[model samples]
Target: MFYDKVFFLGKILLHLSIIYFMIASNKIIYDRNNYSDKELISLYKKLVKPRLIEEKMLILLRQGKISKWFSGIGQEAIAVGVCNALSTDEYILPMHRNLGIFTSRNIPLHKLFAQWQGKKSGFTNGRDRSFHFGSQEFKIIGMISHLGPQLGVANGIALGNLLKNNNQVTTVFSGDGATSEGDFHEALNVAAVWNLPVLFCVENNGYGLSTPSSEQFKCKNIADKGVGYGMESYIIDGNNILEVHSKVLEIAQSVRVNPRPVLIEFKTFRMRGHEEASGNKYVPHNILELWALKDPIENYQNFLRKENILSEELEVLIKEEIVHEINEHLRIAFAEEEISSTTENEIAGVYKHIHFIEKKPNQNTTEARLVDAISNGLDKSLEVFDNLIVMGQDIAEYGGVFKVTEGFLKKYGKDRIRNTPICESSIIEAAYGLSINGFKSVVELQFSDFITSGFNPVINLLAKSFYRWNQPADIVLRMPCGAGVGAGPFHSQTNEAWFTKTPGLKVVYPAFPYDAKGLLATSIEDENPVLFFEHKALYRSIYQEIPEDYYTIPLGKAKLLNEGMDLTIIAYGLAVHWVLDEFKKHQFSADIIDLRTLQPLDVATIYKSVKKTGKVLIVQEDTLFGGIASDISALISENCFEYLDAPIKRIGSIETPIPFAKNLENLYLQNDMIIKEVNILLKY
Candidate 1:
C-alpha cells in the first residue's frame, strides 16, 4: 500500500513537470505594440488604399468592364503587412486572392487593368487571367490557380536562392483551405528538413469557400501545425495592420539572416465572397456581420485616427491621388491593342524548326541493339552541346545504374554533371530553374514509375511555362520506361500516356541509336521542354553505325525503318525493337514507322504510311485502354479511312497492374507473340 502511494506521487510529479514546460513554451514572447506611431499609420494607409482599389476593381468586374476579380476585402492586413515586411529582392508566390500584395509590390496599375480586360498589355501578355500575373524582373513567381501547389515551388525557389548564397527570402501565401492538400504537407516537410529561407503565410479567414475552419482542422490553431515540423510559428491578429506588419517583418528578417523557414498564421476574415460573382448565401449572416465589424482597413484607419497619426486632410488627399492614378492607368490600358500578330508569330516561332547543322551519316551499316544505340547516342551528345547538364540520382559519379551516362562526369566536371538527391520533385524543379536560367538541363528519372513524384514540377510548371508566362523552359526529362527487365511494378512502368494528355509538352521515344542521337540533339537545340522516354530494354540495343559528329533529327517526324507494300507496323521505343525482331524472325517485310515525337505527333507520316499499306498495326508497351496504341489506331481509322484495305489492329499490355514475376511481367508487356497478331491482318 505504501509503494503504490509513492508511485502515484511520482506520476503526479511527472505530470506537473510536463504542464509547467508547456505553459512556459506557449507564452507569447513578442508583442506588436512596440512599433512607432508613424510606422503604424503608414502601414494602415498602405493596406487601406489597396483594399479600396480591390473594391473598385470588383465593381468594374460586376459592370462587365473586367472579366473577373479575386478580392482580398477582409484579409487586407495580411497582404499589406507581408509585403511591407519583405525586401525588394525577396520573392513572393501569391495565390489568387492576394491582389493587395501584388499592388504593394509595384505591379503597374495599367498592367493590372489590362490583365482584367484580357488585353495584350496585361502582365502575362493576355495568356493568363488577371490573377496569375508574374514578372521575372520584379521577382514575383506568379499566382498558381491550383490550391497549395505553389508551396512546393516556393520551397524550390528558396532552395535555388540558398544554393547561390543569395540573402533573399521566399514568401508563399495560401488560404486555410490549402493546408489540406498533400502538396502543402510535402512542401512543409521538405522546407523544415532543409531549413529553406521561406515564409509560409496562412491567411486563416475563418472559411475555405463554404467550409468553416472548425470542420476542416482538429488542431486548436493552424500555427500549431508548424510545431510538428520543428518550425517557429506564431498566431497574429490578422485584422490588426500594425500587429501583422510588426510580426511579419520580425520573421522575415530572421529568415533572411539565419535562413530558416517560419509559419505565420493570420487569424483574419474574408470580407467579400470568394470571387466577384460568388454569392454569400452559404455564409451565415450573423457571422459575416460579426467579422465585418473587424474589417482590416476600417479598423486600421480608426487606430490611426485614435493615435492622432492620420489627419482628415491627408487621408482625403491620399484617396484622391489613388483614384487619379488608377483612372490614368485604366485609360492607358484601354487604349493598348491586343497582342500583335508579329508577337504571336515570334512566340510560335519558338516551336518552329530551326536548321541544325547536319553531320555525315553513320558509316557502319550493321544493325545494333536498342541499348547500345542510346548509350552511344548519349556518349556523342555529351561532346556536342556545350551547355548540356546531365543530372539525376546516381547518374554522375556512379555513371548511372544502367551506365547510359558512363564516364560523363569524368569527361565533364561536377557542375555540368550533377548527382541529385533522391527527391524527384526537387530534381525536376532544380532542372526547370537551371533551364530557365540559360542552361540546358537534362534530368534523368531512374525509372518511369518514379515520375509521379515529379509530376507537379513537370506537368504544371515546366510544361506550361511557355504557354502561361511566355518563359521558355528548355528541359529534357529522360525516363527509362517499359517492363521487360523483370524489375517489379515499382521500377518498370510505361507511363508516357499520362504525359501525352497534357498540352505544351513534347514527348519523344527513339528506337535506334541513330534516331536516339538525332532526336536527343534536336531536343537539346529546341527552345521548348521535351520528355525523352528511353526504354530500359533498348538501352544496350545496338543499331547501324551512327555518325560520330553532332547532328539533329527533326521533331514531329517519323522514320520508316523498313518498307513493305502489304501492311504497316506503327511503333516507337521498345515496340519498334519488338516489331523489327519479329520481322527478322518471320521474314515478314512489313513497313515500320518510328514515331520520334508524340506531342507534336507525326500524323502526316502515319496517314501516308497507312494510305499505302492498307493494313495497319499499332503496338505499345502501355496498357490497352487509353494507351498510345489506342490513340494511334483511332487516328489512323479516322484520317486514313478510305485508303484502308483492312481494319486497324492495336496490341498493348493487358489492363492490369504490372506484376513483379518475370512471367507475369512478360505476359503484361507487348512482346513477340503480340507482334504475331499482325499476321492475321496480313492474311486479310
Candidate 2:
C-alpha cells in the first residue's frame, strides 16, 4: 500500500512538469515583443508597397489603358509576406490575381506593362495576357487562370524537389472559392499523404465572386479543413503585414525541416471588384464596410509610423520612386509596336520544322495484335530512351489490369517502372512532375472513364505547359478506351472527344497493330505531351502487317488504308476497324481514311479523299452530337463544298447514357451495320 501511494505521487509530478513545459512553449509562440521594431517595419513595408502598386495598376485599368486586371488590393499581405519569406531557389505557382507578388519578386515593370498592352516585347512574346506570365529566370513555375488546379501542380513540384532531396519549397496561391473544387481536396490529401514540402495559401477574402464564404463552407475557418487531411494549419490576420510575414517565415522554415504541407488562411478582403470592370454592388454593404476596416496597407503604414520605424520623409520618397517607375514603364509599353503580320505567323513557328515521316517498308515486319504492339512499343521506347519511366496502378508487379505494361518492371527496375497509389490525381501529378524534371513519363490511366478524376491536371496543367511556359512536357498518358468489354458504364467509356476539345493537347488513336506500335513510338519521342487512347476491343484483334522491329509514324497525318472513288469513310480507333470489316463484307470500294492524330488533324489527306469520293461518312465511338464525327463533317463541308455529291453522313453512339445491359450497350455503340447508312446515302 505504501509503494502504490509513492507511484501515484510520482505520476502526478510528471504530469505537472509536462503542463509547465507546454505553458512555456505557448508563451514563446505568442510573444510578439520578441521581434525587433526594424524587422517589423521592414515586413510591413514589403507588404504595403505591393498593395500600393496593385491599387495604381487598377486605376490605370479603369482609364482603359489596361484591358484586363485581376485586383489584388486587400490580399497584398498574403502575397508579399509569403514571397518575401521564400528563398530564391524555391518555386512559386501563382494564380491570376497574384501579379503583385510576381512584381515584388522583381519581374520587370516594362514586361508587365507590355503584356497588359499586348505588345510583342512582353515576357511571353505576347502569347499570354498580363495575368498569365511566367519566368524561368525568377524560378516562378508560371501562372494559371484555372481555379484549384495549381494546388496539385504545387504538390507535384514539391514532390519533385523532395525527390531531388533539395531543401526548396513550392508555394501555390488560390482564392477561397477554389477550395470548393475537387482538385483542391485531392491535392491537399495527396500532399499530406506524401508529406510534400508545400504551402497552400488560401486568400480567403470573405467572398468567392458574389457568393459569401459563410454560405459556401460550414467550417468556421478555412484552415480548419486541414485537420480532416491530417495537415498543419494556421489562420492569420492578412491585414497585419508584420504578423503575416513573421508567421510565413516560421511556417516555411518548419516545412523545410519536417517536409510536410501546411495550409494558411489569410483573412483578408477584396477591396475592389473581382476584375476592374466589375461593379461589385453585389457584395453586401455591411460586409464591405467591415472588410474596409482591415485594409492591409493602411494598417501596416499606421503600425510602421507608430513604431517610429518609418517617417513622413521616407514615405514621400518611396511614393515618388514607385510613381516614377510606373510612369517610365507605361511610356515604354505604349511606344512598343503591335504584333505585325510576320509576328502573327511566327506564333505558329513552333511547328514550322514539324514534318510527317512516311512509312517505310519493313523487311522484318510481322503481323501482331494491338496488345502485342503496345508491349513492343514499351520495349522499344525503354531501349531507346534511358530517361523513360512507366507508372500506373497495378502496373509494376502485376503487369497492370490489361497487362499492357507487362515485363516493364523486370526490364526497367523499380524506380523507372513505378506503381502508384489508386488515386488518379496522384498518378497524373507524379507524371507531370517527372516530365518537367527531365523524365520521359508514360502514365497509364486504368481505364478511359477514370480519366475524369484526373481531368484538371491533364487539361489545365499538362496541356497548357508548352503554350503557357514554353516548356515541353514529354509526358504520355495511355488509357484503355471504348465500351464493348462488358466493363459496365463506370469502367467502359470513349472519352477522346473530351480531351480533343482542349487546345495544346495531341490526341492519338491507333486502330491497327502497325499504326499502334508506330504512333506510340512517335508519341513517346515527341517533345510535347500526348494522350494515347488504346481501344480495349481492338487490343486482341490481329492485323496483317505489323513490324517485328521498332518504328514511329508521324503525328497529325492520316493513313489511307484503301482507295476507292465511290465514297470515303473517315474513322479512328475501333471505328476504323468496324468500317473496314463492313466494307469488306459488303464488297464496297470505299476509301478508308484513318485519323491518327486529332489536334493537328490531317486536313490535307481528309480533304483529298473527300474530294475524290464526292461523299463522306464520319464514324466514331463517342456520342453523336459533340463527337469527332461532327468535327470531320464540319471540316469536309467547309473545305470540300463543291466536291460533295450528297449530304455528309455521321455515325456515332446514340445520345444517351450507356446502359449496363449488353444488348442496349451494343445498340448504343456503333457497329458494322452503321456502314449500311453510307450505302443508302450513296444511292442518293
- Cα displacement (Å) at residue 461, model 1: 3.0
> Which regions of candidate 2 fall more than 4 Å away from where they truly are?
1-45, 123-130, 276-295, 302-308, 338-368, 382-391, 407-439, 456-465, 468-473, 543-550, 564-567, 583-590, 610-617, 641-650, 674-684
Query: Compared to the true structure, candidate 1 yields what TM-score?
Result: 0.82
Top-scoring candidate (lDDT): 2
Clashes of each: 13, 0
lDDT of the candidates, in the order given: 0.77, 0.79
Candidate 2 at residue 293, lDDT? 58
For model 1, residues 35-152, the per-residue Cα lDDT tens digits are 7866765675677678767767877876888787766787877788888888877778787777767778787888878887878777666667867755776677765576656777
Judged by whole-model lDDT over C-alpha atoms, candidate 2 comes out at 0.79
